[model samples]
Target chain A: MPGVVVVGQVARDLVLVVDRVPEEGGSTDVRERQELLGGKGANQAVACRRLGAEVELLGVVGADRAGEDVLAQAAADGIGVGGVLRREGVPTALLVDVVGPPGVRRLLEDVAPAALLTAEDVRSRAGLLQDAGAVLVQLQQPGPAVVEALAAARGALVVADGAPADARTRRRVLDAADVVRADGSEAEALVGWAPRGVPETVRAARELLEQGPRVVALAAGDADVVAWADGHVVLPHLGEDPVDPTGAGDAFVGALAVALLRGEDPRTAAWWAAAVAAQVVGTAGGRPHLDPDRLRETVRRHRGA
Target chain B: MPGVVVVGQVARDLVLVVDRVPEEGGSTDVRERQELLGGKGANQAVACRRLGAEVELLGVVGADRAGEDVLAQAAADGIGVGGVLRREGVPTALLVDVVGPPGVRRLLEDVAPAALLTAEDVRSRAGLLQDAGAVLVQLQQPGPAVVEALAAARGALVVADGAPADARTRRRVLDAADVVRADGSEAEALVGWAPRGVPETVRAARELLEQGPRVVALAAGDADVVAWADGHVVLPHLGEDPVDPTGAGDAFVGALAVALLRGEDPRTAAWWAAAVAAQVVGTAGGRPHLDPDRLRETVRRHRGA
Candidate 1:
C-alpha cells in the first residue's frame, strides 16, 4: 500500500510550444507538442512516486477516453489509482499549455464540474486518506471536498496545497494542516497581498507558519521562502532561464512532502524541494521527470554553497 | 465518384472556446471544446461532399494516431481518402482555434514540414486530380506542391484558394486557374492591397479576371465581390455575428464549386456560396455540418432578393 495520498485533479495536459503568439486573425505554427497525463494532483503524485514514496491518488476524472489514457500512465508510473473516481456523463479534464517566446505561457483549462471531486467522493476515500503516512490536499477544489479530505486524514502529516476555495475551507485547512505550500497568487489569497523581495516573503511565510502549519512555503518574485518555528531559509531561483514553469510548484511541494516523509528536517527538506523544482522548470509540461540521484546531487551542491 | 478534388492540408482541428483569454501567468477555463477532422483541404472537401458532390481529398498527414482518427472521420463523412498521403516520422498536423469574445479567434497551427504535401505526393495523385470535375488547390502549401496540383488539374475547373507562396507559383496558378477565391488577406497578396469596400473588391475581382480566371471572388470588409467577363455581383456578409470564422472561406469556395458543377449559373452559384458561408460561421470549428435542402432554400431566397 502507498504511504502517501494526493487528493486533487487528474487531467490530460497538452503542451503546444510556438515561436511567437500570433495576433487575432493570424496564425503561428507549433514547434513542439506534448500530450501527457498531468494536473497538480497527478504531477505531485508522480513526483513523490518517482522519489520512491508509495503514493495513491484521490481525484475525479470523467468517464472518457482521456481518463483511461491518463490512468494507464499513472499505473505505469507506479502510482496507485484505485481511489480515483470515474464520474459518468462527462469528458475528462484537459489543460492546454501554450508556451511561446522563451518563458511566456497561456493556459486553457477545461475542468468540468463532474471532473472535480465532490464531498461524497472525498468521504468514500476516507480509508485511503486515513491510512496514508502523509496526505496532500489541493484546496482549489470545492470547499466541501477540501474540508472532507482534511477531516478524513486524522493523524497523517497533512499538507495543504493552493488557496482554499472559501473562508470556511481556509479555517478548516489551517486547523488541520501540518505544512502549507502556495504560489504567488495563492499566497496573496492566504496573506493580504503578494509579498515582494526575500525579506517580505520571509515575513509572509512566518505569518502562515503561525496559522497551524509547522512549516510554510511561499513563492516570492524569483525566489522562495520557507519558514518554520525557529528559523527560515530563502532559496534562490534556478540559475538558468526556465523552459516552462507550469508544473514547478507541484514538483516543489511533492519533493517537500517526500523529504519530510523520509525524516528530513524542515530546512533540508526545503532545499530538496527547491532543487527538484529547479529541475522541473528546466523542462516543459506539468508532469515531472525526476532522477532521484541527480536531484540529490543538486540539493547537496546547493546546500554546500 | 465525387467530382471535386481538394489539394492541401489534412489536420486534426481542436476548437477551444474560452470566456476570455487569460493574461501571462494566468489561466482560464475552456467554455467548450470540439475536436474533429479539419484543414483547408478537408473542410472544403467535407463541404462539397455535404452538398452531394462526390469528393476526394489529396493532402499529407503524419502517420500518427491523429492521422488515423482524421482519416476515419473523412471516410465517415463520405469523402474519399485514397489520395491522402500518410507520411511516417512526422506527427499529424493540428490547428487549434481559440475562440474568445464573439468572432475573435486566435489560430495555433501545427503544420509540420512532413505534414505538408510534397511535389512528389501531389504528382502521384495526377490521375485523381485529372479525373475530377473541379479541383480546389489551397495555395498555403509549399510552392512545388501547389504548382504540381495546378499542373495536374489541366482540364478540371481549376480553383485556387488562399495566397500563393511565391511569384512563380502565383503566376502559374493565375495562368492555369478557371476560378479564384481569396479572403481579405489573401486578396492583398493577389493584388497590391486588401480592398476596403464592395466597389474596390469588385475592381480587384475584375483585375483577377483579366489574369486568366473566368470567375474571380474577392472578399472586402463585410461583403464579397464575384466578377466575370461582363459584370460582377457583391454579396453582403451574413447578417448575424460569426461564432468562429475559422472555416467560412473554405465553405464558401466549396459551395461555389459544387453549385457550378451542378450547372448553376455563376450568379446563382455565388449566391449559394454566400448562403453556405453564412451558415458555416454560425458554428465553431472548421468542419461544416451542411444541409443541402436547407441551404438550397436559403440560396434561392437570397438569389431571388
Candidate 2:
C-alpha cells in the first residue's frame, strides 16, 4: 500500500509529573516519571500507521541508544524507517516535559541531530514520496530540508503542519501545501493577528487560504474551523475528557491526509480528523491506539445523520 | 597505585527542578531539567577517583546505550570499569529525582540490570579487592552480591554505606564491615531507636559497635559522630553553604577509606572524611571536582591544629 510519507523531527521525551511549579530557586517533588517516544514527525507517522495507513518516516536521530530505540519502536509499529538517518557524534533530541495536574505541561527541548538534518538528507529520500498517496511535512525540521521534501512531493496531496518555523519557511510551506493545519496560536502567528472566536477564526483561515493552500484548518481548544475558497465549516470537539493533548494536532493532520487521500470531501475529512484528534487526547503520549473499523462505523453514522 | 574497589549500582539521573511538591492530584511546572550520572556505588567510586585513589567499580549495567555511556564516563574519570558487567536484554538503572527546595528531594528508581547482578558476579572480581587499600560496598545491590563482595575484601579495610536494605542484609553487612556509616534515619532503623542529639547519636554509635562493626559513623545534617572500640569523636561542619548534599555521605565514606588506608587514627580519618564531605555538599551530584594537592593540604592543616 503506497500510503503517506512524513518528514519531521524525532525525539525521546522524559516526562515528570509534578503538582505545582516551584519558585525560581526552590525544587518540587515528582509524583511519577516515564520516558516515551515523541517528536512531531515520528508522532504523525505513528498516527498515520495507527489510523490504518502505511507510513514512511523521514528524519534524523543521533547515533546513540535513543536513536536505536526510536528506530526500533517505529519499525515495531509498522512505520518504514528506511529514510531515518543516524548522524554520528550528535546526541538524539531530548524533550523533557513536566506535566502537572489537569493536563498542564511545560517542555524543554534539546534538538541535537535534528539540526544536522540537511536538504541533501531530505532529497535522498525523495523517492519515497513519489508514489505516496499523500505527503505530510511538519515545520520542525530545517527550513531548506522541509522545502526540499515539499518540492519532491509534487503529484501527491501535500499536507503541512504548522510546527514552530522561520517566517520564510512558513510562507514557503503555505505556498506549497494543498492543505495546511494550524492551532489557533499558530494561525495567529502566521497571519500576524489573534482571532477571537469562531467568526474571527474563519476570517483568519480565509486570509490564510489566499496564501495558496486549497484548505486552511484552524483548531481552537474545543472548536475547529476549516476554510476553502468558497466557504468554511465549524466543527465541535468529541467532548471526551482529554488525558493529554500533546500530539492531537499531529493526529489531526495525519488523519486529514488519509481522508483526503481517500477522496473524501474536505468537510468530511475535517470531521474525521477531529474524531481522530479527540481519541488521541484521551491517551498518554502522542500516538493513540486506533481501531479502523470503529472509525469507519463512526464516519458512516455521521454521514447518515 | 592500588586504591579502592567500589561495588554497587550505577544509574542515569533525570533531575527535574520544581518549586514545591504539588498536591496529590495537582500538577506543577518544571523550572529546569538535567541528565546526570548518579548511583551510590558509582558516586563513591568517582569520589575516590577524584580524591586521587585508583578506583575500580564492580557493578552491572544493561547492555544498552545507557550502559555504554556510563562505562565511558567511568573510564574518562579514571575509574577502572573492567569489573563492571554488561548484561544483555536489560536496561541500565535510571533514577528520576524531583528536587524541591534545598533539602527535599524524591527519588523514583528503576533498578533493572542492577537487580540482576548475582553473588557470583562479585566473587568473580575478588582478585581486584585483594591488594586494594580499602573496599567500599553500598547496600543498593542484591543482598547476596553485597555479602559476597564484603567476603572477597577480607584483607582490605571494608567500608559499608547503609542504603535501603532488609534487616538481615543490614546485619550481614555490619558483621562484615570494618567501618560502617549511616545517616540519622538509617541508624535509627537499624538500632530500633532514633538518636535525637549528639550525645544520643554517640551512645547509639557505641551500641552499634556491639553489633560487630569495628567502627560506626553517624552523620547528622551539620554534625557527624564516629565511634570506635576505645572512644568516639564529634566533628563539626566546614561552615560553608551547601548547594546539594545528594552524595556527601558517599564522599565521606570514600575519603574515610582513603584516610584509614594511609594509617590515620580513626578520629583523624573521621575529620578528613568530614572535610571531603563538606566539599561535596557544595557541588551538584555525588562526585565533586577535587584537587589532590588541596585535599592533602587540608588534611595536614587539620592534623597540625
Candidate 3:
C-alpha cells in the first residue's frame, strides 16, 4: 500500500522507574532505567508500517549519537527517513521520564523547532508524497512548517493528528485536513465541549465539523469514539488493560490512515483503528507491534471484515 | 598538640570531572548541574562547624561518599565526625561536576551542594571517649554495623548527627559531649562520608601519627577542626577569597570543638586545620588543610585569601 507519510518530532525517551517521588529535599533510588526511541512522528510511522502500510517519516535529528540510533532503527524497520535533515551542532531532543506511582513525570522537556523539514527537504521528497494515499501530521515539531507541507501535498488525503494543539494551532491546521483525529481533551480544548454519551458525541462531532475537516474522529478511551463525517458511526473500544497508554493515540491515527488508504470506509477504518489501539495499549513502552498475523487476525475476528 | 580527631575513611583523592568522562552511548548534553556536597557524613558535619573546629559528624557513608567528603574533609579541616565508619555501598565518591566554562559557572555550583550533610541515625550516642573535646558522627547508615556506643567518658567529647540511615534501623549511639548536625542526604542514605581531599589528608596524617584519639572530628569546606583522645584540638582557616566555598565545612566542628573548647590545644586544633588546607589549595573544597597559621596565611593571601 502507498500508506501514510508522517511528519513531526523524533526524540529519545529516557525512561526510569523510580521507587518513589523524591521528597521535596530528599532522594529516592531508581529501580530501572531505559532509553527508548520515540517521537510522535516515529511512533505514528511505526504504527502505520506495522499495520501493513509503507511509511515515510520527516523530522530533524542532530548528528549526535542519538540521531544515529534513530536512523539505524528506522532503517531496520524499513521506514524511510530521507526527508530528515541532519542539523550540525544541534543536539537530538530528549524526554527525561520518571515512570512510577505518579504515572509519568516528565523532566527537561524541549522541542528543537529547527527539526521540521525545510522547504528543500520537502521538495526533494515531493514525488514520494504525491503518490501517497494519506499524509499524517503531528504537532510535536514546528506547527507552521508541517501545515505548509501538508498544504503542498495536493493529491494526498491529509490527516492531522490534533492531539498536541492549542486553539491557534487548531485554527491554523484543521481546515487543511481531510480527516482529523483528536483525543477528547483536544476536542474539549478546541471547541469547549465534552462529548460523553452517544448524543453528546454527535454534538461534539457536529462542533468539530464546523472546524472544516470532512471526517472528525474523537477517541475517548474506553468510553467510545464518535466519528461523524458523511454519517454517524459509534466505534466503542474493546476493553484491554493497557500497560502504558503512551503512543496509543498515535497508533489509532496511523492505523486509521492505513485503513482509509486501502479504500475502507471511515466506519470500517475507525473500527480497525480501535483494534490496533487496543493491541498497542496492552503492551508496554508504547510498543506498536504485537504480532502482524495476530493483529490482523484479531481485527478480522472482532470487526468481521 | 592534642590535634583534631578525624573519624572517617582516610583514603586517596580521585577527581573525575563530568566533561572529562565518557557518557553512556557516546554523545550527551552538559546540563548546568552543581558540584554536589557528595559525602553524606562529611558534608553534614563539616557544614555544621565551618567557622572553626567545633564540629563532629557520625555514620558510615561508605568508601565513596564517606571517604571523599568525610575522612579527607575532616583531616583537612580538623573537625571530627566521631567514629565515622567506612564501609562500601558505593565507590569512593567523585563529584562529577560539569563545571561551566570559566567565568559564570562558579555561582551556580556554590548553592547546589552547600546544604548537604550526613548524620548517624543507626548508632547510639552514649559515653565520651577519653578527653574528647567534641564527638561527631553521621547516619550514612551502612549495612553490617561497625559503629557502637562508647561507654567511657574520661571527660571525652561526643556529638552525634542523627541523620536518617537504614529504614528498619537498630539504634547504635556514641554519647557524652558537644554538637550534632544532619542534613538531607544523610537523612536519606542514613550514612555519609568526607569528600575527596579530606580523607587523603587524614590518611597522610594517620599514616604519620603513631598514637591518636578515640573521638573523631570531620570538617568540610573551610571549617577547621581537631578531636581529643577524648579531647580534640582546634585549627583555624581564617582566610578569604571564598567566592563559592559556601558552607566552609559547616562552621560547626571548627567553631565549637576546636576553637571554643578552651582545654584543647590550638596548634593542630580544628581551627588551624582548614586554615592549613586553605594555604595549600586556597579554597575549602580544594584540598586538605595542614601546617601552622603563618604558612597557611602566607599561601591563602597568595591564592587571594
TM-score of each: 0.93, 0.79, 0.56
In Å, residue B169's CA in model 3 sits off its true spot by: 15
Question: Per-model C-alpha lDDT, please?
Answer: 0.87, 0.77, 0.53
Query: Residue B236 of candidate 2: its Cα lDDT?
Result: 76
Worst lDDT 10-window in candidate 3 chain B: B103-112
Model 1 over residues B48-142: C-alpha lDDT tens digits? 99888999999998887789999999999999999999888988989999998768898998888878888999889899998999999999899
Error of 2 at B298 (Å): 5.3
TM-score of chain B of 1: 0.96
**Residues A96-115 of candidate 3: C-alpha lDDT, one tens digit per residue:** 44444433432333345555
Residue pairs in candidate 1 whose N, alpha carbon or C atoms collide under 3 angstroms: B2-B54
Q: What tens-digit string does per-residue lDDT give for candidate 3 at B164-209?
A: 3443331334223344433322322222343334444344223212
Better candidate number, 1 or 3, judged by lDDT: 1
Candidate 1 vs 2: which has more TM-score: 1
Q: Can you tell me which runs of candidate 1 are displaced by over 4 Å?
A: A188-204, A286-288, A291-305, B188-200, B286-288, B291-304
- Winner by TM-score: 1
Which TM-score value belongs to model 2?
0.79
- Fraction of native contacts under 8 Å reproduced by each candidate: 0.89, 0.00, 0.00
